[model samples]
Target: MKRQIVTLPLSLMRVTSIDWDIDWRGAPEAGLTDGNTQVVMNQVPRWVGHLDMTMRDDWLRSWRAHRWQAQGRVGIYRLYMFDPLGFNLQAIVGRAVAETGIPFATGERFSSGSGFSPNVYLEAAAAASAGDTYVTVTCTDADLVPAPGQIMSAGDWPMGVVSVEANGDDTYTLGIQMPLRADMAAGDLVSCMATGLFEVDDDLAGAAPYGKLNRSAFSVSFREVLNR
Candidate 1:
């Protein structure tokens, strides 16, 4: 069976600083061995990584108002060992920071393996060693859409649309909702023509720039298919 996953792409606004904390603790003993050997294991300092991001207000506002329904915010953020790496994880961390209404100053700490780290070093290392992993976040308004002529599929079924939007963000969100059936599955692929408007950075406007807004064809995978 096939399903769809809808997601929002989050731009890396900027990294204020990268930081970490190390903690040393003893491990629990398994049991007494046959011999009188009490195997004392070495206690190593565990390292936790953190990345503080100062996001632009425009980006945060656009994401909250249009994409996530105002789910997350900005603040000092930390990531553990097991969190999904890259844009997916960062988008979520951004949301959490936004939702808690926490100051952009205080940081939150989590265990290393709970799968919620946002540290760039760790993420890069993980990505380098293994093939890139895919992470999904709530759909955002500023997300880029798949362009026309882009091929999307639901399982093995190919899809087609009239147009598409290309915001250049990781995930594709529709500026206007499309006509879809109610029985869509969670992992189903959606291929359609997409078009939308986007706010470009001032710096990039001069080079290879089209307009304050441009229309284009795009393609995206659904993170979660919504039930009608």
Candidate 2:
């Protein structure tokens, strides 16, 4: 399977570390007269792993929004972990939640140059099947139709627009570079970043920036979902 790095937009707080721990529920067998250990295993033992990471409080509003939507409940998400040293990609499918409360932290402000906002959000209108070149996208107030040379990203796959057609009822069919890989359910958020745009830092002059630099960490405990 093609795997890409997972990015939680709200989890951009100070991510200090990613700690992964695994457990194997195996029972050790006792030895007889030799005083040595002997084990008899019929099947593989239960295996599990958890991912823990810390984030500062720089972007607490975004984190709060995420937490509110989650309702402090567990939900399954496709999380990607890349190991550069081993050249391995671990795409985990399991349930996750925010198990800790946000702590108040006083710190320096986070600063960055102004960035362009996305021209339009590519919202999937229906479940898209693989090998379908044309896709239906939600029409926004701008209703901007992508040009042939323009690029759009769905998840991690970036594709150029070959053609576009309005399907009516505030929806359009986009002929992309190729068909999609996995199916995209309706309302999946896809971004079309505004390329070649510049913005001045006019709003940063008098902002107090009450929140601390985002150091709020997110810890998710998950167990691999095994297929029957």
Candidate 3:
């Protein structure tokens, strides 16, 4: 594949919130005689996203420069949005927890422990056809597992996690919010979706009071482009 697709940095996802929508094809139509109007709809859909982030004025300045470098409103940058529900993509502690405790003279004990879930790579375990809701995947990352509510992409097709079930053989079955859009093979990359890709095809406008005070002050618009 050509390197036409540019991946945005994860640091760009410091958004306070996002306003996402699906831009499906539609047209207003009216009966010639009665003048009754109706919206003619085509189910072809694309993602329309609005991002709001608070950052230093310098950062916002650089963002504007980046957009200018792209010739304004004509750039394809791959963006990855984070999961809304916290810890849904984080590592889950196993059924056991090991802690070392020491008794103190104050009648209080000190127990120190640690649990962290860093980013890890993932892949599918079997070939799956388009329209399949769940796909089996294997993760070599120890103590870390994919969880429900995480949004990910496979073969460049976006999907959200609805369920995660373990198969007892070091593999997992993940139910996706949207079924596969195309067939995928075994060993294909099943990203946990910490990546970024945003195509700028619209105006980058926002009302950032005092540089970056309001929640929606610094906002950028992105439109998902599949074949643009």
Task: Tally clashes: model 2.
Answer: 13
Tell me, by lDDT, which candidate is best.
3
lDDT of each: 0.27, 0.42, 0.59
TM-score of each: 0.19, 0.36, 0.64
Query: Per-residue alpha-carbon lDDT of model 2 for 151-195, expressed as tens digits?
Result: 555664444467878777878778864446446789985545211
Clashing pairs in 3: 77-197, 77-198, 78-196, 78-197, 78-198, 79-196, 79-197, 79-198, 80-195, 80-196
Q: Which residue window of length 10 is worst by lDDT in model 3?
A: 93-102
* TM-score of structure candidate 1: 0.19
Name model 1 segments beyond 4 Å from true.
1-6, 17-51, 70-228
Error of 1 at 207 (Å): 34
> Model 3, range 1-228, lDDT digits (tens) per residue?
333554443333557886654566577665566776667876445556787777545444544444555544455666655454522332342222211122354645322122221234577899999879998899766544777767677765666678989888889998975567669899988767533345775544433445234222467787666563
Error of 2 at 10 (Å): 16
